[model samples]
Target: MIKIALVHHINFNHLSLSFKQRTDYIEKYLEKILDAIIVKTNISICTEDLLLLKVWNPKVYRRLINHPKVNFLFSTHNHAIPLIYPETFTEQMLLGSKVILDLINPKKIQGVGYPSEVDFPPKISFESICKVWEGIILGESRIKISGLEKDEFSPVFTINDAWSKNKIRGHLSRRAFNYRDYLHKYFRDEANSGEMLLGIQDDYKKYAQGSVLLARIDLEVILFNAPIVDGIQQEPPINKFRDLQKYLINHNVDFLKVADLDKTDYKIPEYRISDIAPCSSENIKWNNKSLKRRVENIKFDRSNKLKYGIWLSLQCSDYYCTNFQDLCFSYGDKNKKTIFITKTRIYRDQESGIKLKLLQGKTLDQIKMNDNELEKYMQYFMKSNELLTNYL
Candidate 1:
């Protein structure tokens, strides 16, 4: 039996359900999936406990390194070394600017402000620039520009109805530093290809901030280090469809939207330069056209009742920590503060951990004497977690 160790982001506890509830739910799911595989193979199957970690907490890793069964670590947050973030830029280079062209955009240049530079089609328009700028701030990479094309290699981009020059400009840049350092060794063969890294654009490029450039360099390390695991692959190769499936299967990880996968999976570049037209201004104007729709289509033929509701912690806090803040609100009472406490536990200073001044006097143990108090607390907590699902 393959021993699998699942690593969770710190955000897991911050999810809607109580820590016990979430763990129980995941435990059952893992058993079911493995049970099927075992029945078919008729082999003894053993499962290791899933190891959850606070991705941002250095202490967690310190403990993780000591775990005996720990192997195949995965993360939703940035932790790989060499931070991977996004960068977006407006112009390829300034006059006489010292340029380090990715092989794909290999044009020898002396410095940032040189006027003798060869001119090509306006590589970026003002509208596109603005879009990418917004994308950088939002940590979302959604636009790209086409660069030199090659007949031997299949075009890396395709046109989509949702394309918008303005939206394209709003794209963000992703820098995955850990992956970059690891991937570069394998990419050395192509070191001389003179091919611009398929796509490398960042709004951060405009600022020339050392931090942003460092992020870009880290991203290159990620690209260079990516280990296309034999069968593991990112799907849709676009909107994170594949990444979500992988996380769901391996991590028992919870996510509400496909976009959330961006938070769950290891880094993947966000720019799609080959499909510049969809992100162009003219196309962005017709975002709803038959050819350019961006949002997914949903069908509602049946009644909608949520089975689970998701709760998001507006701020980060640790369990039983006095400094924690209660971010969720109680129903019918804007001023009333609430903290989600499971019915099984009783505490005097529940509010002391994650104080919600509004919930100043409320306590699950104190409220337990009230009729239906547990259900009320669970439902309210579930609503905040956004875990309730509705099926018609």
Candidate 2:
């Protein structure tokens, strides 16, 4: 049977509505959607919306929590950033798991909805994070389940050129394959005695439909992104819902809760980057002179190889330069007068650059040059940046 897991990520905190309006929206649209299928199908619903629901509408929260057809998974407290970025793996898991534990009892917490759809590189730290999460939820047991969104590799292909399209697909396919391989290698036991079911998102949408089918993934966690609303803004409009229902029924799809897979023993074979024959960076031509100069100018501290390498890469990459600046602003030491000093001087340089930018009227909208505003901005900036650079 073709199994499909229906999952919804309700981020109430980020919803563009007031408390009463949100509650009303949920009742009018969300409830109706559930009412239509709750009895006919099994669904897994997760939310970062519980904090608001618990405080403003306890009755609704209780009803959903107790619903027989609904299986609630724990998404992070706020689904704003990727859990892998700003914090250590252990810290992210603890914070996210704690939110779920606080809302519902530990027994009810079956799995987690990783906050973002970003494809994380295969790092040992990621594996360690998964182990820690297993300990917290399963406790002395080895079985664990993680549901990751699948839109990362193939969100859409808008390129008109056939060659470009093929190139993009090739790159994405390798990344997806490597990620799946990484999970099998790092999470499963060598003896094939443990179960670590990884569910990849496969929303019943056109963009990811092809990739999802190609992957032949074990679990398909379908997402419903549009919020239910009145006056025709509601998602999965009546016609679309009917089409989806027909598609599933025609395909002999089994609608089930994602948590139900924990009962099954599934093993994914080990695959690695080498298996895909990935293109080496050495082959790519370095045409960007500015980037080359930036990398060449940044001197690395051999004492801390990992930190130095990361810093150097961040300095060279446009996508990460701002991130590097934010990191130094938040964590870089300012006490040059201290008796004992650290070897890293790049952070101080980064701080100076930021100050220069501020003086040149290039401050971020949230920050100002004034003393009061600067202090508040720094405090807020540190917290926000830590959310992304926490692991570093």
Candidate 3:
């Protein structure tokens, strides 16, 4: 049985939805895509056979691509950035995963590796949008994977005839997989049969613009499949966990930690977490480096504090929240700091019974969060003395 890993970034483009609403839409939409699988292949893919993960950084995403246990790697991001490849762990697993890299616009480029030859389609449809994703699996398994053989350069394209007869930008299978066989199998079945489950990011619309939506979708795909309980759990930013809880409940899915999933049967359990989680490459490296150098870096200090809402960036526009700038720059005045808390989002910290809360509730408009808010959130960091290790 091949295990598919659908990694995606989250972005809110289609709907004027809240974090919870947006997640519901994406999870359902992606689930529909997975349900469409059997139409293209006879393979029976269970929700348990697929894993979802959310990566905050490109480094973690890149590593997931090379993970051996990941039979197939699908990313919905726009630009492909190079980062720390989790090559070691994947190689050790030796799962022979296939990699899928998605490009929003393929016709505009000359070729897969070079410039394109065709003009960009005037109007792209969701049904025919060009998403360049690669996969690393065996020949038979290749057909089971949708668009597995499709690349940026292909003679035949799959466009919605109802909408337009426009050609798809990506190429069809070029190597081990035969295009004829793939098509025969794909068209032979009118409908697909499989358990469908959608994965979405509960708090994504607030932070994403249309330009970055695709990148966010890439992370969302990963998170949707990732087992969350064993995923990286950092301190101070309890809002993340709160958001995660909301995601599970809103989707009508049960939540289980990574440890729990490992013990459960292969049959799809309500929900499961992954033992090997992905993290930001830069953040992990910064944490791994020596502490002395981190303190010397002012930017790292600010970022560390920003994570907890203690300090804000001077580079931040004035239109955003100004609290962080005021408090961090206050120099020695401790009285200038104020505790800002969220009333709605409250989660019990398993490690500490103390309730974790969001610092700000207002939707983050084009304007950024107040600097003061950052300073207020960092109180936990300052008290714990763990901020020093977060520096570069």
Enumerate clash totals for all models, in the order shown. 79, 5, 64
What local lDDT score does residue 195 receive in model 1, on the 0 to 100 scale? 21
Worst lDDT 10-window in candidate 2: 135-144
Predicted candidate 3 versus true structure: per-residue lDDT over 95-139, tens digit per residue = 111112121122211112100011111122222232331211111
Scored by TM-score, the top model is 2
Please list the Cα RMSD from the true structure of every candidate, rounded to 1 decimal place: 22.8, 18.7, 21.9
Worst 10 residues of 1 by lDDT: 39-48
Candidate 2 lDDT over 1-392, as tens digits, reads 44444444453322122233344444554554444443223222222245435444456667666666555554433332222134433344444556565656555555533432222312333444443233111110111112122343232221112322211111111223322442333221111111112223222232233322222111111112232222222242333333444544555555554444333232322222223221223222113344334544555453543333233223211122221111110111342211111223233234334433333334355444344433432334333333323322
Candidate 2 ranges with C-alpha deviation above 4 Å: 13-23, 39-48, 83-85, 88-90, 105-108, 118-128, 132-251, 259-267, 271-392
Using alpha carbons, what is the TM-score of model 3? 0.19
For model 1, how does the per-residue alpha-carbon lDDT over 312-336 read when each residue is reduced to its tens digit?
Answer: 1111122222322333322223423
lDDT for model 2: 0.33
lDDT leader: 2
Identify the runs in model 1 with alpha carbons over 4 angstroms from their true place.
1-144, 148-171, 175-381, 385-392
Q: Which ten residues in a row have the lowest lDDT in candidate 3?
A: 40-49
